[model samples]
Target chain A: MSSSTKHSKWRYVLLGVTAWLAAFMIPQAAHAEYGDVVINNYADAAGIRPAVFPHWFHRIRFRCKVCHADLGFQFKAGGNKIDMAKIIDGKFCGACHNGEVAWSVENCAMCHSGVPGTPTHFHGSTVQSLIAPAYKPLEGK
Target chain B: MKNKIILTSALALVISGPAFSADGVSAEEVTASAATPEPVVVAQVAGANVFNRNLKKVKVKNAPPPEDGIHDPENEGTYVLQPPLEAYQGLPTSPYGNYVDWVKAIDEKKLQPRWDRIDSSEEAFVMDLDVLREVKASVPDVIFPHRQHTEWLACSNCHPAIFIPQKGANQINMSGILLGQKCGVCHGKVSFPITTKSCKKCHSQPKPEDWTPPLSEATLKNPWR
Candidate 1:
């Protein structure tokens, strides 16, 4: 083959190799898909239930800027330095949980009503009916 | 012509000498040259601050060790500022776009659940049929703490869906979770941050065999309550 033709062929080969290498080296950038905010931190440590913070429910009722921007919640779980004292003092959850806006702090059973892992007595009745109607004994018996 | 050919060969050898020659230069010289690169050698001899540029912006001046000998950053009251819990600002059409906005708007609606009012109750913690079925199908029941979670989160955190006021109505399943539904919602993301093979981390019980506690027991205990 002529030198010019050979050189052109070599150029094509080099271009192919370069393209393959670039494709192999570059990772596909994955975009974040919206979903739940799982909280695996301190759940077992704090003896609390596996905390699953579902984002879908709250979004329908409120806006993103409310809690995250205004209340100062960290995007990541365990990111917030939350303690009971801070909450009772009206920080974090306490800011709104002060009774007027949401459930009153006096209503301990609303959250702390049942044991961890054990269904709350208040809500248990409904769940029991759906899953195990046979498990329920006669009222007085 | 012969001389020209020889010269060309010699030039090529010199250009590619390092590739072919096992000992192109003295080992000691190579080692010394590598150890004393231009930047490091220049800084050492000048006695100038290496991180001067970074220090100026943050105002963090390095000082001699304290007499007490404690080098903890916490003691110096210079802890790293945590990233705020703001909604991710990346995607315009996030499945949780509205949800992220809702959490941000928590302070405005005044709908944030009180830490005290948070249902840390064992009852609330109880895994519903959907959650229990999913756990039992794959592994053991995940010992969840409802009240303890409430302390850390707002009611808007997992209301109306992962859980509903009406029990047994919420459709939580392994499929949905794996698809980022229900508990899987945050397990792999912002919460425990699920992994491909993190079964034991969640499903495993609190027994000693496979137990690994991340936080201190003191922190776990409900001191205030």
Candidate 2:
């Protein structure tokens, strides 16, 4: 192969790699999608991956009030103060996750499954994304 | 000397690297546990079901018209059928229940949900009665409207099983609702969800400071008289 042809091929490879990297970065800047909460409160210090809560998955099976009202999950992200010890103790997340209603804590990978070094808060969280479209008063109408 | 030992161990963590095991724990966690007792290194699974990464499992939502399981690949007409995503583009949207806002659609007269499926001779029984539920909380009291519910449901839907026809017979509370009872039977599942944003939708009537329970129909009517 001619030296110029080899150089042009290498240039194209470099351009392709740079474009791929840029494509990945744009989504990262948006910083997480709606209905996902990355809980890193204690995971990094303990060397475990951050727990990524999928609100979408749970919402599909169960109702909003099930967790929020009955199980006592606060509306704000990072507000519940979830810990592995508490989960094992059969509180908060353990209510359903005690090897019966859902998967138990021993199945650690499912909940504590996130890329290392991820921050505690997820941007574009559910509450912020789905704020009341303004209260429509229907009573006494 | 201790600093040197700690530094060397920290470096060892990097050198040993993360373990990819069938079980989701890292080999690093098992070995490093003696030194750092609570350390738990998770096996890194790329494209894990995090951040709705379940979508990564299936590249496209629906296969192209030719390969879609429902469509007959041999037929040309199957290829020309409207794509599902494109067919739903312009309608009003809600965050839940498949993202379509049927309530607003009805208000705008875009789509009518029901074309009187009941026998045309028998007019739909539409009740306009409102039952006030006086709550002890400082928040506004709840007003259950029969008009809205009866429009979609027959009286038999909730009568003997879910709720007895007589007042104060069936007990109700927030916890019961959360546990998929009474109002929650439909509200959180199919209808609008019981979210913080939607609290006022049900809890609308302002409670009176000197509120008293209303009398029963039997006590007031005295049918014989």
Candidate 3:
């Protein structure tokens, strides 16, 4: 009766990260929503806000391969090693961000609008959610 | 970013929703797309960011055709078209893209997605193989169903490109997907955003119970055959 194990705070962090907010967030609306990713790798050193990739905005218009395959964008957030140089040179995001395809990379605030201290991750989705048999505190054990 | 270019010259392209024809779409893919793929730049103002606002949030979803972001709200002609909310009525729903369960609808014959654009008579080269990626210690193994994807996509869409078409040829993991490499390419983007609710959707294979491998006869201290 005395065998009680204390759960770590990190576990709660994972739980909070994956906690489904849509159930409570939806206020009488059947809307479309996709995950957003935040990339902060370079911004920390570059003295700029983290970039917020609205994947849904792009994905809605093209196939996954167009960016991931043809454009050579890595699937993971921040995995593309994006920078202004590459964008100006027309590499990763510059492929479409150019004024011709969509918008030019000169629009810094467009992507770099993310919060200052965000980590590189899928905005709403977290690793703990994708893993099966997701952690659940045993009920009334 | 929500500026209106309803009466502009580009309205024709914007109204049809071309340039971003949404791959894996159903049979209704009108070859309205241009030769070179481009963003849906139908109504962007000069010097303006393509997406001026955050992508995660939408003010109104599935509104009437006249008021929907893509439609020409000022034009009375646009109002003649049925609203998405009405069209989506009595259909299967999901918590993702358009909130329609297109897969279930397709399976139930309510939707018949063609396999090709040029060949109307062509049947999908549907494959039924399921590859299991084992993840021991925690989480169930992932079950890759070829049939579901092949029905919507083609061999060229993935084979030897995103993934090699051979056993043990490709390396896959959640990290890569989270990084937007493997399955992350489509999922968590257009198809279905990754969520805790969908973990079992892909990670479907049940893990084997705790057990040891079969012991060799030599290990039993008997003359092993």
Candidate 4:
């Protein structure tokens, strides 16, 4: 009933809210969504689904230079003007994903999972375990 | 005399007040802030002052009769000359000639004509810039053999200026090239004219289906070599 007690309760409520928001705002290393780069250059506005490029999945297999330097990909996401037209032309992402290389470019939903409720194909506990033992966080004592 | 001095000072302030107020900004600085290029300024000045709007009314001397087809008043007498086919004959039908033969000949001191400075006197080095774009196009894909071009021109002639080195930066197409952009900057003018039915000169290689991604360095090597 006291004013000091009321103020203490208010402070606790504010701290709890702050902690909850921080959990969502800060990027988590273990999560697949952490390094996801949204490529909405022409997709979102044009009614097509924007692509969510998973950096974490690709980084495990290939070096940065393979895509960035050798393939002439701009360092920043969406920096290179990528479109379906150019992709089909065997440029940009199409360089490696041209059916014969890694995966077919025809598989749209594999990358274009930015639409709400769209299930990401790579998000699973089994895939997380496959990320190698070195990348995992240190365990508690 | 005091009134004359005051009037003169007022006139001087009116004449140079903006320049002084601008914190050392010159006339060039004002124009440069707009980021206008020198050629645009020259054109505007020439149109407004030198040539004047009245110049359009004046009749040009020895103007060709209207009956002449394809008369360009701007170029006047200058004509786009077709590159002689004889110049390319006997040269390797393949891009950059036979690289091995040329190198072997060089070692034996029997390389004919040599990689001489015909287009430029400066030292030019061979570089591979073969890019495979438009694989599905009707004709063969382009293998932009730099050795073929570098044999004549310098690196400074194209890099970072005319053609940006970044891949996919320059959207090259036949229409744009014909419009004097990209390759048209020189091809139609100083270099070989594209209209001479020399399409195969560049697009010589066919699209290799099942062509592996991450082009192997072996393919990048001089095909002639």
Candidate 5:
């Protein structure tokens, strides 16, 4: 093959590779895509139904920083040791569930709403990127 | 002929060096390419299709498209149609581009939901400052009090949409926050305004003397409600 012809062909191949890499790195977001976290840490053992955390509902109104960064929530399900005491102490769930900020955490079944036979609350398509364990809580806390 | 082969090999190495050195490409592919000649490297470049095929393992479960009625007619019968607008499309070109203006519009239009709290999540959160400090931030690291905001707002107020819910996902800085990106989303207008002069409000430490450690016998027994 001629030198310039060979070079141009390689250039086309390079361009194609670059285009493929870009698409692979950044996948399109699914419309109304969301994921759920089933927190079984202490809920089931405590005689309460395991709490199911929804991603889509919360994401629309508030930014993730409020809970994950400012509020200090771990990204993984059952990652944070959330308990009733902590909630009542005005920590974790308590921070908001207190009567002033949100509905008082008086009801046990609010988050533990997912008892057996109750259909889990589901919404939005599942986002592949978000389904991964993204929240890495600060270390040495 | 030997020099031509060497030149081709050199070019091949030059192209593939980055993918190998960065350790992002597969190790198996790297090892295979390393033992082969220039033409083999070219074939390996072609094999990037295989790499992409592996990445395609991320399955996007098809959900019904919104009934917005903007889908292309050609794909009406198919589920592969694109949304009306891409996510990264810029905000409306109106003067109300900033947070304050947008909030005003929301209030005027009664766009704000009466129930700010979502039906779920009884727990609030408190992210520690230690993580920020560890990054060698010049200023005292800011503390996020989740309950303070969660009372009024819902989770979608900020999340994977605005600030990714993951640590190290968003590049937050005072300058950007001041310009109304991160904390600036509300702090200035809706929430408390930030002052560059005063650092203690958000940066205050858990008073060493008054701090009751978690897992304390009393806390473990029944923390003060």
Candidate 6:
């Protein structure tokens, strides 16, 4: 085959490959899934891991208006002025967690357990992991 | 060659002059014809846009009025608030199931409210029971006329579930209600669209003074009998 003809054939093959790759990449980019809660406020400021709240779990227990409207929680994270003192005084977490309505705040280490160099283990599993175990089939007969 | 060229030019001018001026056309005629076509196209586009806008408004207006009449099962999906309780069967059970089962089931077309159908109102009355109770402990239990509501609803509309069959069994709380478990199923979405009037709807009762005619008649007739 002539050199020019060979070059043209190779160019067509490259174009085809590029077109195929472009089609495949578009959908993945468009529908990429990301974590719902991105705690950029406290951690980025103090160089530590800020608390990551999973909406999927909390929503199961209570309604959005109960906390948002009734308890005065702001819509955006970091917007609400949450502090340890208020929680202990039964303002935010204390409202329910006074050992009656929900989990108590007596165990400070539950939320603030992280140390500087040691690896921190937040006890509860992710929403997916917690739900997955519940759905497993019963053990063999 | 020069004589032939001159003869051809003279013939062309004579032929064109008569055709160009035959009806004595003016510049205005030429301009008007050119300008006319542009407006017709612009008018057509404008008409199309108006038609689309009107259609959108109509669909939106019609949608919520009917879905709002009955309880909404999920936060998602289109709805209206009409009466006489049409059911939307086959919806999955709400993760939190406090809504009247009839209303919830209606979403799945499983059950229908037993009532006559009526046009839903754009404006809804709000009933805030909390504030009402604070004001008067002896407040009359609001006699919500079920028959009136059924004019636009069905039997399964608020039965066998949303309200427990055993009267007074379902003690609704704010926390449980908000999770779309109990009364929240219909209040926020359908059935009088709960608001400030919610208290009046559920709590307001017929007063003793208001009961003069019927009670007085019975009392006078029987005495001690």
Top of the candidates by lDDT:
3
Residue pairs with clashing backbones, model 2: none
Across A22-123, the per-residue lDDT of candidate 4 in tens digits comes to 765643232222233556677756665656565434533343435654466653446787889988888878877888656787677666645322222222
Cα RMSD for candidates in order: 27.3, 24.5, 31.1, 30.3, 19.4, 22.8
Best by TM-score: 3
lDDT tens digits, residues B10-57, model 6? 554456656536767544453344444443343457755655533211
In angstroms, the error of model 3 at B114 is 16
In model 1, which regions exceed 4 Å deviation?
A1-141, B1-138, B205-225
lDDT order, best first, reads: 3, 2, 4, 5, 1, 6
Clashes of 1: 50
Model 2 chain B TM at 0.50
Once fitted onto the true fold, the runs of candidate 4 whose alpha carbons sit more than 4 angstroms away are A1-141, B1-123, B209-225
What are the per-residue Cα lDDT tens digits for candidate 4 across B148-174? Answer: 565444566567767888887877887
Q: After superposition, how far is residue B213 of candidate 3 from its true place, in Å?
A: 16
Model 1: per-residue lDDT, tens digit, B64-116? Answer: 11111111122222122111133323312212222233322332433343223
Q: Candidate 2's chain A scores what TM-score? A: 0.66
Minimal lDDT window, size 10, model 6 chain A: A27-36
Return the candidate ranking by DockQ, descending.
3, 5, 6, 1, 2, 4
Which of the two, 4 or 6, has more lDDT? 4
At residue B170, give the lDDT of candidate 4: 73
DockQ of each: 0.02, 0.02, 0.06, 0.01, 0.04, 0.03
Poorest lDDT segment (10 consecutive residues) of candidate 5 chain B: B93-102
> Using alpha carbons, what is the TM-score of model 3?
0.42
Candidate 5: residue A127 Cα off by (Å): 9.1
- Per-residue lDDT of B1-225 in model 5, one digit per residue for the tens? 556655665566678877666877655554455545465333456555544534343233322233211111223222332331332133232221111222333335422333324443344342322333222344444666655455445566576666787787878776666554677655432244454433565776444453443454666678463
Q: Write the per-residue lDDT of candidate 2 for residues A1-141, one digit (tens) a residue.
A: 999999999999999999878755542122222334667788878987666675434543444445655566654456798898888887778977998777677767666655556566533332223453111211111
Cα lDDT computed for each candidate against the true fold = 0.42, 0.57, 0.58, 0.49, 0.47, 0.39
Q: Candidate 3, residues B107-154: lDDT per residue as tens digits?
A: 676555434322336665678999887764367778899877866666
lDDT of 2 by residue, B1-225 (tens): 445655676676566555334457565664455355555588777567456634322223423333422222344443444443453456677764334554465446454333232222444356889998877667789998886665445665667767888878878887667545777555554456666767887899987877766666787898775
